[model samples]
Target: MTAVTKIFHDRLQVILDNHVAEVRLDHAERHNCMDVAMIDALLEAQVWLAERVGVRAVVLLGEGESFCSGLDVAAVVSTPERIAWLLQPDATGMTPAQRLALGWRDVGGPVVAALHGHVFGAGLQMALAADIRIVHPEASLALPEIEWGLVADMGVSVSGAALRQDVIHDMMLTGRHLSGEEAVILGLASRLDEDPREGGRELAQSLALRSPRAVAAARRLRREAPAMSERECLERESGLQRNLIGGPEQREATRARLEGRRPRLA
Candidate 1:
């Protein structure tokens, strides 16, 4: 296990290995609650990975037992200062949760989330953003924002469309949590594992073994399959490569391979 650096004290830790990076929610003391600072750090990690070189896969996980409990109720209710900060716009001029959720789509590589314990509210949104999710057999997944007198945001509408409408409605409307087996049955999770971390790492390595170009192309296809026309999707493919080929990150990646060194960000 490589020593991942913690980007921010109030946020999480990120570890970049040969061709894989892992983002771990580090707020275990509070069940990895979604506070303003954690949201900012999550978005920053995505932006960093977007520009990263030689990275073919990413794993999203929580540092401790539970994946994430949800929004920090104390931060939202007891602390006006914290709530004010969360309401502030991010660098992309998006709300903190919006940035954190949408940023995953911008990351160039495939992301697989290793979910365990409780994954509720905004945490479920984060998990939904990943290309694949391998959840623990005992894990609980839910969307409880509606119970809090707020509509679900954080790109849930777009991403949740991938899951069955009935399943999505069941979780979103009633705030009911689904077990890993139930999630898989409902098409909410791709796989169930006894140990999500090991399963996630194995999947990441498998994905890393494939051609980076092909992986990226497949990601593009999957992301655009819903709303984009065939012609639009083809154009998107060309546009993505146009931005990547001969790019700074690609150059660094090639150089790193030849030099037998970890690729350094430009």
Candidate 2:
């Protein structure tokens, strides 16, 4: 049976079904723009998902016309308390605003984002945090913070590390928009889909059927490989494989493959 949970007054809705959790950003009237309240909700939602080891996959979506139109600057800057909350740093020197993107990394499962319409500034950064991004061909993505005399500070440096320096420079300097197809070509998005939400959900559902332990290990390896030496990566890969060789999930996977049956992993 599926379970649904709403938190932060439904600004964030989490639907957990068959080990796949769909997190919906529900502030539709403003294209799900990140207001102070919405930011709080997202931060909380990420923290909530981080604690759930059973969640094999996560699909991030936004309600209504757009995935997200980026930050509501007027709303965020007008509130003193919210400003303080956004700026306050944790032990690692990461602010709550920064956490909005990087916190998704704490979730123990692969995250897939379904993006459409305007995915601008912080919205683009948030989508970039996802392991896979499914975007509508017509979706507009931009790094518009430069237009406001601000840098893209919501963990853009960390999340966009793999992007070409020239491509990053062009978007940041020009504050121009890129369509979903162009984004895919530039390596900003995983793929373009006619219905990104459905595509994201289908992908997440398929990932949920895999052995969670193996999936988690692979996810970690993918995240770490870029930073590790080739020798270190090989050693790490071998160590992880050794740990899984005789594990319950591994045995189950082997048994199911041989029997031509779906795996019932723990």
Candidate 3:
């Protein structure tokens, strides 16, 4: 029996297809903005994915024209206590905002984000947490927190996007937006495609076919090594390589390469 439950809440959808799970932000009328309810749905989804041992890849995409448009200011401000609640950590020891932004990453599998339209603030943070990002040309991303006299807090500091200090400062100070093409050029996006959703699925499928162990290890190294010193990073890399070089997954990968065919390893 499948261990994962099919959840279709008001603001989110969790659907598993084969080994690739798709988590969709579905509140399109509000540009799929992150509110308290959606955040809770995402938290539940993180646990769902974490418990599903058969899932090899995760694809996060929005339901409408936009992937996400950051927080719902009107909704958030309407509730006085909600703002304070966003800062409270759940059972996962992660704040609500952090859990929503980084939940997909917590799953021990590759996460691919397909972005289009407005990818702002928390949306961009989610993309940053993704191991691979595929964005459409028309997508526009921004950190508009400064305009609202707020910081783009949502645990965005650990984002793996290769943005320079100057670029980060400029965007944060001005709340400026970046196009999808520019995002790719600036290393915020892995690649640009006409149909980002399809592209994300293709990338996730490719990852799902690979050895999950190797994929997870590489993702961890890429996602976390930036915070380490050069020497520490190098040592970690070598240690991971040594641990993987002769492992079952590596051996299967090698055999598949030698046979000139797709690997059939589990």
By lDDT, the best candidate is 2
Look at candidate 1 and give me any clashing residue pairs. none
True-structure lDDT of candidate 2: 0.89
Write the residue-wise lDDT of candidate 3 on 104-218 in tens digits.
7777578999999999988888787787889998799898999989887777775643567677777778999999999888878889999998888888878888988788778
Provide TM-scores for the models.
0.80, 0.95, 0.92
Model 3 misplacement above 4 A = 1-5, 89-93, 160-162
Which pairs clash inside model 3?
Answer: none
Give the per-residue lDDT of model 1 (tens digit) for 1-266. 34346476567888887678878889988879887677667877887888877777888889788888888765666878766765688776767666667678777689898999989988888888889999998899999988897767777887887779888887888998899888888888899999998899889877876557657777877878789888987888788777777876678778888998765652
Candidate 3, residue 40: lDDT: 71
Clash statistics: count for each candidate: 0, 0, 0
- When summed lDDT is taken over every stretch of 10 residues in candidate 2, the lowest stretch is 1-10
**Candidate lDDT (C-alpha), each:** 0.80, 0.89, 0.83
The runs of at least 3 residues in candidate 2 whose Cα sits more than 4 Å from the true structure, single-residue gaps closed, are none
Model 1 accuracy (lDDT, Cα): 0.80
In candidate 2, which residue pairs clash? none
Q: Write the per-residue lDDT of candidate 2 for residues 47-154, one digit (tens) a residue.
A: 788876688899999999999999999988898888788879999999888899988888768999999999998889999888999999999999999999988988
Mark the regions of model 1 whose C-alpha exceeds 4 Å error after superposition. Answer: 1-6, 78-94, 229-266
